[model samples]
Target: MKNMVKRYGFNVEASLPKVPNHPVESKEWLYGRTIINAVRVVMKAQDVQISIFGAENIPATGGALLAINHTGYYDFILGGIPAFVRGKRLVRFMAKKEIFDTPVVGSLMRAMKHVSVNRAAGASSMEDARKHIEAGELVGIFPEATVSRSFEIKELKTGAVRIAESANAPLIPLIIWGGQRIITKDIDRDLGRSHIPVFISVGEPVDTSGDPEVATQRLFEAMRTLLDETRHSYESQYGPFDGGEPWRPVSLGGGAPTLERAKLLEIAEKERRQAKRDAKKAAQAGGRRNPVTALIARLKKLIKK
Candidate 1:
């Protein structure tokens, strides 16, 4: 180890810029950051209110999995702002094809190199996500699949966890306190005010390659914690729940505990485990071993007599 170093910060998730060792660093990175900053400036000038937490936990450089709450569609703007101002990293989101069909916004999205996913297509979206993460770009996804209608939060989708594991990246859970998910434009038109408030919060990073299943569960749990924290923030000031109980779907999102997406999660889990085993065997065979493999071997030895 070349004198390894580690640092930590609170009131923010690990939303740091993590551009890997690639030639992509110099090209349009600072430029894109400037664009996002301009967006923030325009938003602030118009009196768009945004509260952000967990601003310092972001890593200096590497890949990361971002799990953001699906509030108003504009929450995308909020999430991207952090990367823009602080991390200086462009975020690649799983956008719908319809967004690309637009005129100006679509052109902007395509120009920025965002990921478009066909949710109706089985595991194809998963495969595309894997490729993007491998490329060392920051990825943000709303694990609820689609934004919820009421105050209710639907079962989270676990693709974020799977991607983190597959790409050996850290998972960052993001929660937005309030915003109009369905009537997103209402807030923008209402002089920076809306029925649902907007406050963005980031949580700590969860290493997914450590143990696929364990890490996935932890990622989901962390998201839930972030949600509770966000919702609680709203209720503390706003008071009285809208009777929106937490709903769930099986095996889909990180901690949903359902079976619908179980097969995919299971398949990914198996691959992660086997990948660790292969790396361990290779290391024992005198090849380089990843830290995950070394950790697993040490754990196994501890469990044995």
Candidate 2:
């Protein structure tokens, strides 16, 4: 491992390019730029050495739907690096509504013009993404809908193909490996100078002109292939998985859960969230049925009459 690290690891200072002074039309607003600059500083401080491959596949001009695989919370940030490197393109990611409801982070997400998706009312968010793409903006979406605890490609939602077909944009498959080492599900985070080697790969735009189901399947296969290649390269350079590394996937003989187990965990999580929502709604209903509240309502109606 030491010899491989010495031979293959990169120096952060040498890997990153000089920050570009993006033009106003980039649509990276003042707050967005500030957040991105801060993120750059944080990434540098953490000594993250990112290697982006096939960045040229990201079109220099026009709308593109980046369908990225999700493994960790930082996937969104790391996944955007390729587009930025390609042509200073800022991707408007479609994230969950819970993140948008967050206090400071939510404000920043809005300021960055990210689209918020409500799982129950997702059409609005899809429409928002379509508009962004139609206007020649790059849009990013995690087709898996949530982080894959297995560190492998999960079954994808059809939103990626649907949005691309509707907006007449190219759907690009992208994958990021090694960000899971910094932060991921069921693991403690190490935000220090870990010098983690992060890998990002972009594949050619997928053909979304066909049936949505078929296009989604093709997109999934493309991402899975890209992920397999990236993971193999990462293990070759920085790993000889001893079958104990929590960050490595089970398929690679590491400690992460298998896809079947991860699916069960996701279902459990969804049920837990549903229970919480049900409790909250019941409490609200009980409040509305309070005798004092009912009396006030009746009095107001009588007065109006």
Cα lDDT for residue 55, candidate 1? 47
Of candidate 2, the 10-residue stretch with the lowest lDDT total is 1-10
Instruction: Please give the range of 10 consecutive residues that has the lowest summed lDDT in model 1.
Output: 1-10
How would you encode candidate 1's per-residue C-alpha lDDT over 103-162 as one tens digit per residue? 987887777777777768837876777777777777888777765433335566667778
Q: Which regions in candidate 2 have their CA more than 4 angstroms from the true location? A: 1-27, 287-289, 292-305
Superposing every Cα of model 1 onto the true structure, what RMSD results? 19.7
RMSD (Å) per prediction: 19.7, 5.7
Candidate 2 per-residue lDDT, tens place, 1-305, comes to: 11212111232223334344345434565534666677778888999988777666777777889999999989888877777764467888999999999998898888888899999998988999999999888899999999999999999999999999999989999999999999988988878998988988889899997788998999999999999998887889887757878888877988888999989999999899999999999999888787988999999999999
Q: Against the unseen true structure, what C-alpha lDDT does each candidate score?
A: 0.60, 0.83
